[model samples]
Target chain A: MWCQSCREEYEERDAGTCKECYEEASETEEELKREIDDLKSKVAFLRLVSPLDLISTTDLLLHAAGSSSNANPNSSPSTALPCTPAVPAHRAVLISRSPVFKAMLENEMEESRSGIIKIYDVSYDVLRSFVSYLYTAEVLLDEHMACELLILAEKYQVKHLKIFCEKFMTSKVNNENAIGNYAFAHRHNAKQLLEAALSLIMDNMATLTEREEYKELVEKDPRLVVEIYESYLTRQVNTAAKDSTLQP
Target chain B: MWCQSCREEYEERDAGTCKECYEEASETEEELKREIDDLKSKVAFLRLVSPLDLISTTDLLLHAAGSSSNANPNSSPSTALPCTPAVPAHRAVLISRSPVFKAMLENEMEESRSGIIKIYDVSYDVLRSFVSYLYTAEVLLDEHMACELLILAEKYQVKHLKIFCEKFMTSKVNNENAIGNYAFAHRHNAKQLLEAALSLIMDNMATLTEREEYKELVEKDPRLVVEIYESYLTRQVNTAAKDSTLQP
Candidate 1:
């Protein structure tokens, strides 16, 4: 008879014992010792093959699985092994929260420093923004960030990033905020931003009669005044001519 | 007695002539010969002093009367001398109309072989506009001339000229002529012109859909669609926000 739990052989009668059983029991102790030794060897083998203690546990696990498949072509099915733990999400957050990162992000977000942010060799604020974006997938761009990030995008040679920034900044330059936006556009030499600013300024020209504020601007750049007047005159002339032609 | 016309020294009894009638006639002839010599010297002296022979002749006539007291600081008063014949004004006009003078003007106006027409070195056709403006105090700049002259102006660092051209082009950019003006603006990289074109395009965006000719343009630059839609949305959003805020 065989013991199912221990996988050991035994002889059984009414008493479940024999003369050979007594002698075999003494020898069974020695066999048990040998079995314990075999178990120890298996434990040693598992320790050598397992990746839990490796520098990169994920890399070790992948290596071990690949090696095992290569070693046994027709082995019985094996249980899935545990993998290395994933990188913590808070680590990225902690890095972005550093004082250095905060300063760098703040500097990059400032509109006045636009076109001067070089991401690869950038100050701490820009790096923080980049890290934050990567970790959270959240783009925190206000008007200032939108302008600065366009420059950063161009600096980093990221075409899609620049387009996204430009889209955001263009939307911000309305009649109310156009003057400040125009300043940023002029500082960075942003063509699209300038065009948007011009349109907003032109649209609101009639209402921007806070003469003292923009008087010097208009005086210094008389061409701007001339442009507005000429455009107005042109429209009036065209409308009159059109009306006359339509009257017939 | 002295003859006022002759200015000859005379003996009192014989007057200005000899006792014999034949001698008197001879004496008169001698006096006349001496007067002719004095006149010839006077004419030569007058020609040396005056730039214009006609003016010199008039000076001599006036000074010989002894009635004129005016003295020219530029030249000594004519010494009661015979006048010289005036040089014709036709000579000055003839020189001005010469082929050499025309050639010099043409050379000054020709575009440099280097493809740069400095505002200072622009050809007669372009310069004729400036000259005409100077003479008539008019600001009539033809469309084609304005465009070509702008290129010359930009090349020569003439900011005023460029501004003038931009103002002219801006006035011309309307729905009916925007396409041509847009092409010109792009060619010259004229920022003002481009802005004008953009404004015209935006204003006429609805009509553009009706025109089959501009369908390809709208398709090629999808941003055009975004610009129009966003502009409309912005106006709506602002109006809605204002109304909602005011409702309280």
Candidate 2:
């Protein structure tokens, strides 16, 4: 018979859905597309003009605290990376986006009073991207940038950015980086990334001890390495129980 | 053959799609749904805490100008309707959401200087809902509220909110209210709502002149009524052209 969709002939065993169901599915798809278009427009509307564009409204300056003396290649020798021009942002926007910022700004903290926030352990570029993400909910991220932003997102309790970075990292997870990613995820409480990385590690358990990351993790945090073994043992027991049930 | 979607047996002629096409479509649907979920989360993240919740951060106050003097049933006698509390808002949010507000605030306008904007001809409830929508991109709307907000949205040049209101009003349009909605939509420059209402009006051309709204519309805006007749005439011409071609 001729298929309504794709206009192809299919054998009886290769048939998918009935004509009524196909029509219903098409309607559902159209409705879903309409909803997506509406949401995209909303996202565009809600997006604030990046503080980078308009400095007049900025109420706070964020400095990358530890980057000044790094002598980074991204910075010129004369500029001394530390004074890399601070990212300007609005207090209201910061407060709305991050609970850490809200509490710090709302209280009589030095940063609140001085209108300057020093973000520790972040490079100037990363800090700029992080602050930009707060305003626009967007960032062009590589794996390194994703990991860096994930740490910042976690530290500031920006759940949305954290999830975004975690998802990116999770997608990039593989056999080689699984151990390292698993360790990073554990440290940052990235459950999704942790699960993805751990699943990859478990799938290649035969080579688990051969990886340098696994050895480094074992040395750095023996407890994390033990947890991996525990999970592997549990998975083995579960599989064995399932196999026994099937035999019975 | 058994239909995969509904698990129902179907005749040979009732087939919808081949298995490969069905699987691909299902995957596409899943991907679309995931995209929608991501967009929804982004919207939620970008949405600000309503200005009413945090007045300390608010830099502007909006008054319902004509509402205070109206001693309508909606307001209590003791309050005299004039003392309706002003809706507090943030200038950054207002500017980002509406071009009218952006220009007014960015310039040295009286409202910008005074930190107070008086929205003309809107009730206290509608004004509050309007400001709330500015922050959250959401509103609980009935027909009356939708119309009121649509007018305010148009006045303020909040295109997102205006489109939202227009979509709501367009969905509610029918033969009974088509004439009134058409007039309202035309005034607000709501093209979608106008077209929907006009289409309904044209479809019921036989009963158009008999309706009380038709008489009211003719009395109120004879030009709009004339346009409706013009559209009907054009439709008749196009139908005749098509019919004549088919006959040949």
- The parts of candidate 2 lying over 4 Å away from their true place are A67-82, A244-248, B67-83
Model 1, global lDDT: 0.44
Report the C-alpha lDDT of model 2 over B1-248, residue by residue, as the tens digit.
88899999988878898888888889989999999999999999999888876776678889886743554454556753346789998888888888899899889999989888988788889999999998889999999999999988888899898889888999999888899999988888899999999999998988988999999988989999999999999999999999999994
Give DockQ for candidates 1 onward, in order: 0.00, 0.66
lDDT of 2 by residue, A1-248 (tens): 88888998878888889988888889999999999999999999889878876576577899887744554555556753355789998888888899999999889999889898988789889999999998789999999999999999999999999999999999999888899999999999999999999999999999889989888888899999999999999999999999999994
lDDT of 1 by residue, B62-88 (tens): 111111253323233564322222221
Per-prediction TM-score:
0.23, 0.90
Query: Candidate 1 chain B: minimum summed lDDT over ten consecutive residues — where?
Result: B56-65
What are the lDDT scores of the predictions, listed in order?
0.44, 0.88
Runs in model 1 with CA error above 4 Å?
Answer: A1-123, A130-138, A155-157, A186-192, A209-213, A216-246, B1-248
Tell me the chain A TM-score of model 2: 0.92
Which pairs clash (backbone N, Cα, C closer than 3 Å) in model 2? A68-A82, B68-B82
Q: Give residue A181's error in model 1 in angstroms.
A: 2.2
